[model samples]
Target: MSDLKLTRRQSLVLGAGALFALGTRGAFSQDATTLTFWSVRLNTPELQAALLPILAQFEAEHPGIKVVNEPVSGNLVYPKFLTAVQGQLMPDVAEAYSYHPLQFAALGQMAEMDDLIKSWETSGRLKDVVNEFAYKKFFWNDHYWGVPYNLDPRAIYYRKDLLEAKGIKPPTNWDEFQAAAIALNDPANGVYGLSFPAGNFHITQHFFMGFMFQAGGSILDKDGNLVFGTTARDANIRALTYLTDFATKHKVTPEGIGSWDTPDAHTFFQQGRAAFGMGTGVLIGEIQRGNPDLIDKIGILETLQGPAAKLTAGFFNPMFVWNYSPAKEAAMTFVDWFTQPGRLEPLYAANPGGLWPIFKSEFDSELTRSQPLMQEMLAKVIPYTTDFAYPGTGVPEMGVIDGEKMFAAPVNEVVIGQKTPAQAIDDAQAKMAALWEE
Candidate 1:
């Protein structure tokens, strides 16, 4: 056997070649139905243990169908799947970001799940399972090209003890948030008010979007035109100014905040170096595991309200069937079954907080009610959650703009004081507008 190497955005496993091999053999075996599934997060022993049994159950129910499950790294899954599409070796079902399926749908490479979902016995309950914003995120062009699988929403994680001691309340709005941050800063005490990720490519964009949305600004308008420079320019500047000021002006954040990413902020919070951090539910798990003492001290809140709205920037992972797959029906069958409340419960159990349920019923279930953090998230954050791509008006190019740091560069300039918020927003607007042309 020759060692096969696959490379594009990132060098993922050569294991994809094994899928190709199995695919070639399955082509010859006409009696059996083989469905190839490319997914991520199953590389761990824990995830594998949880997922393998589900695959077995699916195969047991449908004896003729064989699922060839392959795990890809998170960073490489999208690029590798793109490579598969280009090579005409796309999997029957693949895990993708909310934007990935949209991009693939635009290319006519993804199978629409609207009919399958409509026909499924549980389809009527989908809206109850998946939230409205998520439904809108996955539904585009009058069809659903993907099924909502996992949701991750941003929230403000604060130190309860720090706030109580300072006589500060959890901030409900932007003004209060800034005041609280400033009040909690104690440099000599070796504690900062907030730890933000201004240096991270994706996190910076997310933070900007959250603030922008709160300020009644959107990246794209109803007409699907870029609004950052025209109608939303001032709001964008306001958002940028507010975020950059935490580090540059107010100095409430750590001195190195300009270089911190999600993990860095997580570390800062876990070590009790910061009073507040912005992140998803993963922070709760990190606190539980690394700083057990702070479990009760830590409290989660919805993102701060801007002048125009209260919103939280979020991301969702979806699974989609390929238009080219020979096992489309079988693949859809598996997806339908996999999304069932019973089947999804174990998966959520395997990675609590890290993967939130997309279904409303799941949120109301005993399983979800047991996790107070998730319950609070369901009540407080998920209602206002919006994706970075700008739900309803998201364009495939926006993904490229986000991935290439087109938006992050200008935000970075503002954070470093190299440019004014107005100037940085102008630069980002110009850059993003140019992306549409390309």
Candidate 2:
């Protein structure tokens, strides 16, 4: 997700104080059952072209239902969501961030989805076909709150051609990953082994979480208690030190990464300034557009193996309904129509590897088979993909940790030489623990 540059407090004010301004959009229908759909993907022209037709078709098929598309910026959606919920003006259906559904459900703002899932003709397939681990994250408070639609799991993307030229096999573990980075590092030529953000942004938090999981550490345990400071302290410190070393000790990643965001890091790989980087399937499409010639030369690793474990974390974009929506049934009807088999072809076709298949049936579909790059990439990374709240159910506190950019604070301090890894970890633990208590 791109940075919105809005602090959590700023978003709270927007949600609380600016709600009256939001109601003036004049998009909602008066005579028909209107379902206001909010989506982050709708911000892009390609996605808009793909969805507008389908929404139009839906309105044509359903007699009295009107569908309105409201494109929300990815980073700002959570704040807008909070305001909408507080003001009782929530969109009928929304594309929630990976952790938003859990948090909103905890606040009693999201509608339960198990009953809706049960009513589908492909209910059995829908339950069985999607990635089971990603599916279960929505099962909070003994009920499901959201439906998983898109999977954007993170993986290490490397330049296969560059590795072959240097005779370096793809790195499977952190030791090998760093060794490869050092081997490939040529700063005088403006090339680095890795491109990562260290700035206090959500992308940095995302990268940190991947390494934390890789080191067999987690913020919370299965019981949803703070474990980062207690049980996972050593692993957490090791993970932080390893990632920060890219800029500080090794000097293999770009300098001033402390000021970079997602696009900055991605541009390094897109422009061939970095030999290896970590990102989601979105990288595939962006790389295709930014540098078409480098397309086939890129390869994806399942995830780099750490000393303790080898899994990765990423977004499992889920669609959720608002409990207070008057058009709840109409909203769900649109969701059902949207998720039906072969219905998602336009999105898949518009951006081949940008959005992943949430249904197992989509795997063997001709559209998927047509794109060998997506097939090879998805096959490698999807198996190892899991949500951000590893080992623990996603609690509301986890969302705050991510939204407020807590993970990046300690990381930035370490990168800038303000504190050692242990000290930074101690500070982060105290701050997060206090938040949890609140």
TM-scores of all predicted structures? 0.89, 0.88
Tell me the deviation in Å of residue 93 in model 2: 1.6
Give the whole-model CA lDDT for all candidates, comma-separated.
0.73, 0.75
Clash pairs for candidate 2: none
**lDDT score of residue 358 within candidate 1:** 70
Q: Across residues 121-160, which tens digit of lDDT does each residue of candidate 1 receive?
A: 3556555655555655666667888877778778778888
Candidate that scores best on TM-score: 1
Relative to the true structure, candidate 1 reaches a TM of 0.89
Regions more than 4 Å wrong, model 2: 1-31, 119-122, 126-129
